[model samples]
Target: MLYEGFESRESFDLLTVLKAFIRLLQKSPSSRIINVYGEMNEYDSDMKSWTKLFRDYSAKFELDKLMDQFYEEFTNTNIKISSAILGNDNNIQTIVEEADRIVHLAILPFNSSPKSKTMRILYGIVGEGMGRATRSKVTLEILLKEQHHVKVVVSNRAYKFLHDNFSKRFPSCDEASEGEAAIDIIKIEGLTMQYVNNVFDEKASVLHTMQRMPDMLNKNLDAYYKNLVSWMPQAVISDFDSFAYIFAKIHGLPILSIDNQHIVQRYVIPEEARESNPIAFYTYKCFVKAKLPRCNTIAVPPILRQSILDAKPLPVEHCEYFLVYQSSKSDTSLISVLQAFGEKCIIYELGREEKVDNLKFKDFSEHGFVDDLACAKGVFDNGGLSLMNEEVSLQRPFLSVPVENQYEQVLNAW
Candidate 1:
């Protein structure tokens, strides 16, 4: 999956897309499955209990030996691991070129800032969704279920996660790997992090993040051409985070912009609802504008278009109260405004270790939102692509509170 994009996380979109794809696959009588990813953190809280239960009874093994045991189990199955490509080397031309056959999908995660007009325009072109690898994997699984032969090449980190969670899915892939021809891989070295410092640096500003992008496009293009070139990419199937769509376009590939469901949920609600509840509308709009643009543009099958439209309608029941979460960087004034309603208001502050004694308050840290949302009456949160999508997939009735200065796409998505 593309890890860092307009917004960094993609866990939410991954769950939703997977759920939809899995349901589709189950309906088919016969299917095969192949999966790929970057780094797979098996011990993450979401999968902790499943891993524990699998080990305690289904397959007795020690916690520390999980990786080895997991790999061994897959090796004993029909799945194949032609060769493990370990690092972010973009230079694997030899291996990629030598493949007698190839099925390619690109995955990336993105969230956008509403305050940035450039981002909004970019969304109109690229759209939003989950990472490229993930969408490809889901697509692959569906094809496999149709009894088609499938193979996958993924980052080392993501490979381990799949091995642990889906080792038994493809018993024959193991044999297929052995039959494949061997080839050398060219490695591109380094992991350098770059950031723009100015609030309005042409390239760094949210609007121009893609417009001002230089490296993705060739140097000789006209100004408009350069802007469009930023999102172009080369893979057969690409999952572009925010601006990466520019690269996908240049390379002549189909792009899927993956992100959370809330990005699309806000615009779906009725105008009456938005007017009657100004606070909710304002808050929700803020989130969408601030973050949703990152996933503004996405490529979807025609069959899925109606489903996307369906996401906007408000749930049948209206919640009595709304719970607003305060992240580490939250404004104190906002906290005070939320707590003014007392117990009738549910407020959570993330990051601070200390808990408040006030009856109307609750402390929800970075990790706490996961469990609390499981039983929440209703939720009000940033239009983060990862969390919001998971909430929708879980069938929760919720409202998105996107940050104001960014993410206009989220505001318009519903």
Candidate 2:
């Protein structure tokens, strides 16, 4: 910017700088140009006097009002920005088709364009259990169906599950999106709980998290700066995932909390569901509130997988056997107790040895599992909110054995 007195000064070649700036703006619209040529890159209200030197400047010259006109155009919802203005059409076809342009914060693109109803979303999920993963899968598919570009940040089992599901279905955005869409799944470190004898071990879980904090921070930081910044999402969706929530806050982006866990903080619990253990209740409340206290929260019923949603469940009298699904591997006495019942029971425990009489151990497959659940007389589960909601949806009679000392699961069972 020039000093106010510079109009009368002959100390600098101001014309040369102004012309260079014009050339730079013609090539690319970036703030980087101002930074590159330091001192005097600015608009001068005094420059109107230069029209006296060039008589042609009066011919449709709106140089003095360029910014005002651009602002008006940018703010006008009716103006349509050309695809050419964004980039190579083939490379950013998805973005172009959606008409999403370069923007800062939540503002419309500076270029003249119609805004889109759909958005680019940064979605995060907790990797500890399959509950969050299963639910988020449905949400992601819905977003993709709506043609919203998404980038998922997760870790552990959730990362692998989502990666496998999305990779085969949609290739990278750099490639063509023939009739289908694509996504980028960026993995980061996440936390998990420790269980002993099918009970939550708070001490061990705390220690594990403390030890892994450094690795967690490093991976999240790398993903944040490298992939997340370039993606520049307009909104963030978190399913009990803190990393995504923090990212949304830092970038001043709108966030939508989509998870059942928010029921504790966002809803009124019945007296029966209130804390039997008060200390545990307040502690868990503090934790959940810390992640998302001010965001828009949508407390939804369990989002079931497509298979379960479409299944036709059978009655107990017509069904052949019951199903057993465990989220914890530390259930030492559960199989023995089931075996004593002397009725047929199907279970999933990957490395367990098989026994003949009453129990059947089967490898995990989505089709097989859904089929079993549909025909089962009942279910025995560790009270994962996702599967519990599935059982509820089917109206199947089941017994829930929630993990001890785990407030979320206890409330879920309640």
Candidate 3:
């Protein structure tokens, strides 16, 4: 069966395995696919922000929900999509007792904060693009090619959103109202908002999405080994999220670390601007341990590297300068530094969206980092693995401001 989880790498990895499982199913006449997930609606606050962005931004362009809509119309075959939430008291022992292959997929959320000095702008894009959207189609294609009897176990919320919307779009499939066509979707019984709240709420944001990560992974891994200990289908694929990394480590599952961006952008103050004291160094180390290790370890483009380098141009050009600070918390510090250099500054804090009296501190709820970054004269934020890597690749001359403790590592890396 194919299993899919959405959250972090551990949460979303089942989707990767499901992709392979689907291919195997096509070859086997009567094989089945089973997909599973935690609660979808009960997401980390960052996840909420991202979801809102997707819904709102896409709606404005009338292009949101295109992927699910497109997939339904493209395929015609027997498939069933079902879901069940895994409750608090739910026993993993009960589910995997049958001894079949189990796949898991999880999608984790990254918070929108410049405090994460190691996180680059590219990191966000890659995390959201592949970790969320691409996996859906990749898994679906795998199943169709494999022709396995597909069973998809998902959270009630995910199923409601994905399945219902799918059927509504493609009503002519073999089993339109929900018969098996292309792939089967089954919901796990106990996953609820309460459960997810408890799972991802350790921190105010979802970057702590890995809080319940260890336990959740151990539970799922144990169940998989107990039931299909020997057969161990093809491989377990996971992203760079720690849960995925841990799963691959503990179960000896071959890890497939998928990601697009490489570097995490930390700060983007113009050359004439002054630098402020960033966050602590230990925080930077924690990110590497908790976040970077989980990814497939991809590099960002080269352009960003050049952009960052260019931003800190030497020999003081004394050119008419504008200081645009994207980060809310760092603006005061940036201005202090710029004024020390005797440079003209225009500081823009991203809490509001419009131009206000010489200073711009707009609420960026309607605007995401990508939008903000595009408008930045020189971007300043955390150097996330994804952002830094992509910037380097793109050859953008951005600057990197390491957190207090992480300077050594960042310097060495740059």
For every candidate, C-alpha RMSD to the true structure in Å: 20.0, 13.6, 17.3
lDDT of 3 by residue, 1-414 (tens): 212112222423433544555555446333333333232223233555546534533332221122233224313222222222333223454555322213321111112122322100000011221112223334443433443223233332344534553434332211212122333333322211111211212133334435544333334333332222221222433333343344345444465544322233333323222222244333444554555354435443322322333343322233333334331242336544555655343444334455443444444221233343433444343333444443443333456553333343243234
User: Estimated TM-score per prediction?
Assistant: 0.34, 0.72, 0.35
Superposed model 3: Cα runs more than 4 Å off: 1-83, 86-239, 258-350, 362-377, 388-397, 407-409
The global C-alpha lDDT for each of the candidates, from Candidate 1 onward, is 0.35, 0.67, 0.34
Clash count per candidate:
84, 2, 139
Candidate 2 lDDT, tens digit per residue, 281-336?
A: 77888888886787566555567889888998887789988899887889789878
Scored by Cα lDDT, where does model 1 land? 0.35
Ranking by lDDT: 2, 1, 3
- Distance (Å) between predicted and true CA of 12, model 2? 21
lDDT of each residue in 240-320, candidate 1, tens digit only? 232334434534345444433333343466665556546656765664455333333543432222122234333425434
TM-score between model 1 and native: 0.34
Better of 2 and 3 by TM-score: 2
lDDT of 3 at 104: 28
TM-score of 3: 0.35
